[model samples]
Target chain A: MSETLTIFTYDWVPKGPRGFVRDLRLRWAAEEAGLAYEIGAVPFEDRQPSHFAHQPFGQVPFLTEGDISIFESGACLLHLAKKSEILMPRTPRGEAETTEWVIAALNSIEMVSVPWWFLGLSGDHENGLSGWLDSRLAHVETVLGGREWLVEGRFTVADLLMADVLRIPQVRARGDRPASEAYIRRALARPAFEKARADQMAHFAAADAKRGEG
Target chain B: MSETLTIFTYDWVPKGPRGFVRDLRLRWAAEEAGLAYEIGAVPFEDRQPSHFAHQPFGQVPFLTEGDISIFESGACLLHLAKKSEILMPRTPRGEAETTEWVIAALNSIEMVSVPWWFLGLSGDHENGLSGWLDSRLAHVETVLGGREWLVEGRFTVADLLMADVLRIPQVRARGDRPASEAYIRRALARPAFEKARADQMAHFAAADAKRGEG
Candidate 1:
């Protein structure tokens, strides 16, 4: 929290860490940690060699604090938690519960849903996966239907990771105004959420304007 | 440690957790923790509304620790670590380091590889995922090239979870060399792992034997 941090993100608008959901995750964690940081955006194509060198997978939202580099949205987010007290609660039970949800987001929900959704987005929808997505959406709605978020009391990184994964158009297409879609809208409406969204929008506008002139 | 524990799983097989990874993870942790337990294998087709009611995702290998029902392999393994000192280390930093690999196993290496391997087995490959898997395997090979285990000194739950994820043929296939295969062999040679594999084999054998006799 004492040093000036660099968040290596995507060029143009938000790619991974640059987007509201990804940025907000880091930003909220940073704000909560009281860490002032700068954003350094990397081009989309360059993300593989540039970002993947740091990240085992070719994805965005990698973080560098001095010599330490971390990837995996969950790991980086939890890095914030370990460094900061606000994102993750101080108690053992709280940390354990927070980890439970984090793993759930990656392993249980997002892991399966993201692949299926991405496949569809890429225009190669699987026959079994379509049914699987339907089943997955129903289960998500059932679990998250009544709750305001994945966990209690406040918005944790669980919400941040979950919201972004759910926001993808492929995932959104599953609900058709059911509980999942409603949840995304409600989550996006929060003040922090709005700031995150606007921040991401500004990134895209800058990128688009640059591309247009070129 | 004091009470009899029951683990809900399929007749132990090494593939898909009945015999393969998740069960190995728990039993390994149990061995490390010095706890005695019973295993109950449920049929795969039965994993639907009947068993999935116990676990929403229609997945196998959930745990009933007295009254607390736990799902997800990492959480289950991590939960078991709470009772003792072997599978999980004692310090926060140790746990954090373990948590990163445990997560990386799922999100990075196993995430795409599992699907690609499954497609290879199930006979439907598409969506440019295999290329991504290839790239990811190279990263895994580099990270794991020289190491026998994942973290400091002796084996930890991170290794168990990672071992489980990497045991997939597609992943193991990434390492065509003697060293990589030996790395996997060393991981499998653990007595706890052997027991888990045998259990899964028996489960499959029982099914086959029943069919043959019928």
Candidate 2:
């Protein structure tokens, strides 16, 4: 436990583009878990090789703890949940349920919704969420149907990841779509999430100010 | 423990397709852990509803163990590996290391490779993994670098999932290339993988036969 967990990432908030929004999930998980960690900002070009060795997929948010390295934001978040206390609940099934929401956030909601955001951000959403995106979002809206959080009745890693995923510009742009709106608000309401988002924002702002000074 | 463990999956084989390959990984984990399980094949199209209820993401090969439902091929494989023996190493760092490989398989390899195969199956891969595909193949080939398996000193769930991800048709087609060819051979050498591949082939044959009959 002496070795600090070093997280490889690019600043994701306060206004910089980064890997999938799930990167913020890792940030939130770290904050929620109360485990102090280091973040390494890898430039877009470096996300591939030098970085790819740590992550074969060339995605961001790879975790390096001691000699143990992990990729996949889902994998990293859950690992931190098991090792730490904040983002996860206290039961086997509870953790498993958290994972379910994580998968839903990533594979279902994040996959399509994130793209929708990217499309809107890049003005390329014409090829909307189909082949699984449409129904997935509808299901997401329904799942949040009446709930404020994702599972077992409290905020957990699932909500962190889901909230981050839903925060995508396009997904949020769906404002007043009932489920979508409620889902986003539910996520943003959590104090832990708010802190995490704020932390991400500050990190980017500091980096930007540094760049400006440079 | 009295309740039946229902595995929502296609009557799948290991080597045939990606979905089935993943199912076989779960089965192998179950077998290694000495768990009794039943299988259900949700028609391909209906994977959405049946799987959505269980998966939320509406993808296939999820596990319903007693009341715990798990999805995300990597997560499902990891959960079974965790709940069982041998498949996942028990030591904290060991488990974390193995999990990293699982993450790599899903986030890195599975992300692109699986999609590459989908493009082929969906008939959208006319894009051919030529420039990008060739580059990634070479990269995987290299990181695979002199290492035989993805993680740990021996085979684990990481290997199982990585094997499946690496075995994607897109990657398989590249098997003729010196490095990729070598990688596939190393992967196929495992008895479990051999079982998995044969299973996949039979499933493919049956599907082709059914298609011909129609």
Candidate 3:
């Protein structure tokens, strides 16, 4: 039998980031493709050198399959997408569209929203990136309004990632973008996303329970 | 004969952003892959609906090859990388490493640095993202210090994207990271990068002359 894919994430995170942790992205992709995977954990409070070796930024959600280990949730999603036509279509155009939207979510939208959200964390709700973030979101809204899926008129890793970026609470609450909202809603309604979120929540909850027991 | 790949960019840009436009990334990649390509232009002063259709963010550097249209410089690089082993190795492990680092350069490093640079544009030399940017850069420095190339100890599209992100003046000036400095220097020394930058500069300079004539 082929070795099960292993996803690495923090053993525990503060309540604020429990469900939103990026390991859920890898897990969601795996579930969508019906691929079995196991979760591995590194310490959240004290990152080891080994963790940095796996993820240079010491971030989580790196994946290991057989001898190959990959970092960056976006990259991991692409790797998983390659394994199943269910995650990404096999055709050249379909793959190209999926890849483009995946990069768009990472480089275009999250590039603005993540920093904007970070600035807002210090209680400055409308920070320097507000206008830029709003403009990006508006563009995404325009695109979403015109299409049901980001690629090939079906659910793919592109939708998986774009939806994840849109689902960030701070980003979602920023404005009323009905099409983007509907897109996110439709993506989250998938059983794979549901399983991924629940599994991630339970993993962290178990860690909390273990701490209490000790 | 196959149609040459076409890259789309703005007809003209201000002097400040002349060399830094992202079409350079696609140009550099094509040059490295030894692929024949042509440059096309959209009006810089007035972005048309068609431009937005090709690039949802209305940004430039989308590529068209035959019937396939791909946007996002990162995605374009990947698309081009597939064409030549000179840009990316065909082996699964090499490709995985290259893809991860490519996404890392885009989603990880640029995600922090670009916003940090943008926030600094209004003369706030050190903005809210300064510490985050520094920490991220320091991590990159550590990675670069130990390796000559981002993947497989050879120059790949990962190095191309990472070097491009690091070359931004604001990000480059942030600190004295010798390893990263050397990496950037090494990458810029490539003839492909030189040709891409020169071609891009001349493309815009011609536009300047045209406007003067009109």
Candidate 4:
């Protein structure tokens, strides 16, 4: 189990998705935990069989550590959380609280927001999912209004993932949720998130240069 | 830490959601693991702050085990899995495989299917999410065609969650995916699922009878 931690993503994506790619979630977690990791890439234009083997949906941000390769950014984040108390507290109560919030960020929030955003892509921002998204976001705003972080009264990977899910520009602009807005601002302001975003931007930029040369 | 295991759900939901209520997921898991548990109810028409405290989105299917209270069926399943190797494998690799697929069920498949189903409730089955749902289901069809179970050649919590997600009538009827259909059929055929479904139906039916009497 001596292999370096590797996070996989597309070699290049269009400008629209550059900053929002989920690979940043893994990189941000690794940085927050001060863990050394490397980035691996698969062709974005033509996904290979190996990529599909690693990520069944042919999506990005699958992680490999020695013999174990795990997909789903949420699962990968939890895997990393197990390695560092910085990402998640070790106690049973703390861990359960964090795990529930992480799943909430994925199943409850993203499930609504991503589809709402997708439907809005057809220029119907007031689409079928608008009310559902607003309800979910309003619940989150209520939760955030009362707490600085999602778990244990402190920052955890739950905050990292929830903030990432909420920070999508379209979703951010959908309403005036000052608490959620402040939560996202606080999360993105972390040095780890900043470095992760910058590094991801640079990775895609280098891929663009390589594509030009080819 | 000496308390009994308990699952929480609405005391009554309309007949439309009786067997399909998410507490069925927890009930199914407990039945599968042969664990002793009790059912707890919250008022469906009048959700209390206590209910919201347990489930932020005011959703059903949160679980309490002794001192720990966990929400999100996905999180609760994972938590229950930790208690029994019957729900999830004990080995690290086996557990990780089960976990990733569980998250995939929640984040990947249900994320699309649920919203699609919700939009279709307005009589627009061919809404914006149709193609996306088809694509995701097609991937699952491919995977299920190649393997009977979702993880490690055995029944796990991943299959339980996935089967529940895919068992939505509208989503199931969308396309002629024989493999996925067979997979769901096989999962639902389990005695545990049958018992869980019957118990949930009885619970809600009893509530309906009580309402009628009042």
Q: Say which candidate scores most in DockQ.
A: 3
Q: Which digits, one per residue and each the tens of the lDDT, describe model 4 over residues B147-172?
A: 99988899999999999999999999
CAPRI level of candidate 1: acceptable
* Pairs that collide, model 4: none
Task: Indicate whether candidate 1 or candidate 3 has the larger DockQ.
Answer: 3
Candidate 1 wrong stretches, greater than 4 Å: A1-6, A11-24, A28-53, A64-68, A82-97, A126-128, A175-177, A201-214, B1-6, B11-18, B33-54, B81-85, B88-93, B124-127, B174-179, B200-214
Per-residue CA lDDT of candidate 2, range B1-214, in tens?
A: 5466666665432333444445767666665566777766666644455556776545567877767777766667767786665787788777877877776566555544544565467565554333455666666777666676666667678777776666665567764456556666776676666655465455656755776631
Q: What are the per-residue Cα lDDT tens digits for candidate 2 across A1-214?
A: 5477887776433343632344667777777777788877666544546676776656677878876777778778878888765577777678777876776666556545543443345465554333445666666777787677877878888887787777766566653458767777777776667776676666666777877841
Q: Which candidate leads the pack in lDDT?
A: 4
TM-score, one value per model: 0.79, 0.80, 0.98, 0.98
Model 1 RMSD in angstroms: 4.3
Q: What is the DockQ of each candidate?
A: 0.38, 0.35, 0.90, 0.85
Candidate 3 Cα misplacement greater than 4 A, ranges:
none
| Residue range B88-114, candidate 3, lDDT tens digits | 999988998999999999999999999
Candidate 2, residue A152: lDDT: 80
Q: What ranges in model 4 sit over 4 Å off?
A: none
lDDT of each: 0.66, 0.65, 0.93, 0.94
Candidate 4, A1-214: lDDT as tens digits:
8578999989999988988899999999999999999999999999988998999898988999888899999999999999999999999989999999999999999999999999999898999999999999999999999999999899999999999999999999988999999999999999999999999999999988988942
- Provide the interface RMSD of candidate 1 in angstroms, 1 decimal place: 2.8
Interface RMSD of each: 2.8, 3.6, 0.5, 0.7
